[model samples]
Target: MDIRLDDLTHPAIHALLEEHMAGMRALSPPECVFALDLDKLRHPSISFWSAWDGDTLTGCGALRELDAGHGEIKSMRTPNALRRRGAGKAILQHIIGVARARGYQRLSLETGAPAGFAAAHALYLGAGFVETGPFGDYQEDPFSRFYTLAL
Candidate 1:
């Protein structure tokens, strides 16, 4: 798969993000949903990437610089058509690699706590993220689970 920074204007990226946001809404309430919309993802502090298998959009993920050495993972999503095919893994590994290269000392994320999010929680653990207190503007919330990794 080819992974590279993407412009949200790309139709496939928009469709993929819409699918992801819809899934989050169905699985969790708006307050608990950490998914970012196109405007948020386009922030200057965030670097977003899209994974493609030839011409097909496979998955996408982003890293947001919070400080000199702190970063956050945002909008990680692999389409249903690409689930179980290692697309999520590829996107995550790329994000981790990028974080390390950019001198980030840690990477953190927030995911839903609903049963429908169990697979995603497991995937993050498998990728070496560990549960932690909330970061950034986040607070202790039963609806969300936070994880962090030291780089």
Candidate 2:
């Protein structure tokens, strides 16, 4: 799979992001859904990436700058039809590598605490991210599970 920085303009990326947003909303309460829309992910502090296997868009993820030493993982999603194919892990590792290269001391992420997000939890934990308290603009939320990896 090829993973690289994406400009967030491709029709496939937009469709994938839209599907991600819909899935998040379906799995969590509206207030607990932190998935960013394309506009929000396009912020200057955020770097988005798309994972592809030749012509197929496998998945996508993003990293948002929280500060000079920290970065937040955002918008990690693989289509329902494509789960468990390693795209999730690949994109996550890619983000971690980029964060470390940027001199970040830590990489953090917020995901749902619900059972529907079990795969995500496994992926993060398998990649060495441990459960932690809220970071960045997040407050304590029962519906959210926070994880951080010390780089």
Candidate 3:
């Protein structure tokens, strides 16, 4: 799979992001939903990436600079058609490498606590992320599970 920085304008990226947001909305309550939309993903602090296999969009993920020594992982998604493939893992490893290269000492992320999020939880855990309390501007929400990795 090819993973590269995305400007968030490609039609395939747009569609994948829409599907990701929709999936988040369906899985989490309105108040607990924190998935970023296209506009938010384009924020100056964030770097978005899309994973592709030839012409097909396989997955996407993003890294957001939280501070000089810290960063946040965001918008990780692999469409149903490509689920269980290595795309998500590849995107995640790419993000982690980018974070380390950027001089970030730590990397964090927030994901759902629901049973439906088990796969993601396992994925993060396997990627060296440890469960932790809320970080950054996040408050204590039972619906959310946070993870952090020391780079």
Candidate 4:
């Protein structure tokens, strides 16, 4: 698989993001949902990527710069067809590499804390992220679980 910077408008990427947002909405209450809309991910501080296998988009992920030494992971999603096929791992490794290259010392992410998100929580933990308190604009919320890793 190849991972590269991408415009969020890429149809495949957009579809994957939409699915992820839908999952978030379904799994959490409206007020507790914090999925970034496309507009938010398009901000200057965010860098998005799409992972592909030849002509097929396998997954996507993004890193949002929080400061000179910190970043946040966002919009990480693997296509349904590509789930459990190493797509998510590839995208995550790419995100970590990019964050390191960008001089970020730490990376934080917010994900659902419910049973529905167990796989995601496990994935993050296996990737070296540890449970953490809120970062950035986030506050304590029963609907969310936060994780952080030192890059």
Candidate 5:
């Protein structure tokens, strides 16, 4: 799969993001769902990327600047039809590499804390992220699990 920075203008991206939002809402309560929409992902502080296998969109992820030395992982999703093809891990590794390239000291993320999110948890931990308390503006919540990797 080829992964590249996306401008979020493609029709496939819009559809994928919409699917991501719907999946998040289905897994977590509305109040606990924090997936960013297209407009939000377009913010200057966030860098979004999409993975494509030829003409097919497989997955996407983003890195958001929390500060000069810190970044947060956001919106990691693999379409239902294209999962287990290594796109998610590739996107995640790309984010981590970019964070290091930007001189970030840490990278963190928030994900759900249920069986449904086991794959995500495994992906993160397998990439060397350790469970931690909330970072950034997040708060302690039973529905959420936080992880951080010290660079």
Candidate 6:
């Protein structure tokens, strides 16, 4: 699989992001769903990427600079058919690499606390992220679990 920066305009990437947002909405309350929409993902501080296997889109992920020394992971998603195929892991590892290259000292993310998020929790944990309290603009929310990795 090859991963590269994405402009978020490709039909496949658009559809994937829509599916990701839909899944988030189904798993968490509207207010608790923090997944970024396409517009938000286009922010200057954010770097979005898509993973592909030749002509097929496998997954996507993004990194957003929160401060000079910190960054946040956003919009990570892999299709059901691609789950456990290393697509998500590749995108995550790519994001971590970019964060490190940007001189970030820490990388953080916020995911849902529901059972549906177990796989996500495991993925982050396996990638060396540790459970932590809210960071950046986030506040205490029982429905959210935060994780951070010190680079």
Once superposed on the true structure, which residue ranges of model 5 sit more than 4 Å away at CA?
A: none
Give each model's clash number: 0, 0, 0, 0, 0, 0
* Candidates ranked by lDDT: 5, 6, 2, 3, 1, 4
* Model 3 worst lDDT run, 10 consecutive residues: 21-30
Q: Candidate 3's error at 102, in angstroms?
A: 0.8
Q: State which candidate, 1 or 4, has the greater TM-score.
A: 1
Q: What is the C-alpha lDDT of each candidate?
A: 0.92, 0.94, 0.94, 0.90, 0.95, 0.94
lDDT of 5 by residue, 1-151 (tens): 8999999999999999999999888889999988899999999999999999999999999999999999999999999888899999999999999999999999999999878899999999999999999998999998899999999
- Error (Å) of candidate 4 at residue 71 is 0.3
lDDT of 3 by residue, 21-135 (tens): 8888888888898889999999999999999999999999999999999999999999978899999999999999999999999999999998889999999999999999999
**At residue 87, what lDDT does model 1 achieve?**
84
Model 6 error, position 76 (Å): 0.4
Q: Would you estimate the TM-scores of all the predictions?
A: 0.96, 0.98, 0.98, 0.96, 0.98, 0.98
Deviation in Å, model 1, residue 4 alpha carbon? 1.1
True-structure lDDT of candidate 4:
0.90
Candidate 1 has its poorest 10 consecutive residues by lDDT at 26-35
Q: Looking at candidate 5, what is the lDDT of residue 12?
A: 95
Which pairs clash (backbone N, Cα, C closer than 3 Å) in model 6? none
Best by lDDT: 5
Clashes of 4: 0
Model 5, residue 55: C-alpha shift (Å): 0.2
Please give the lDDT score at residue 144 for candidate 6: 96
TM-score of 1: 0.96
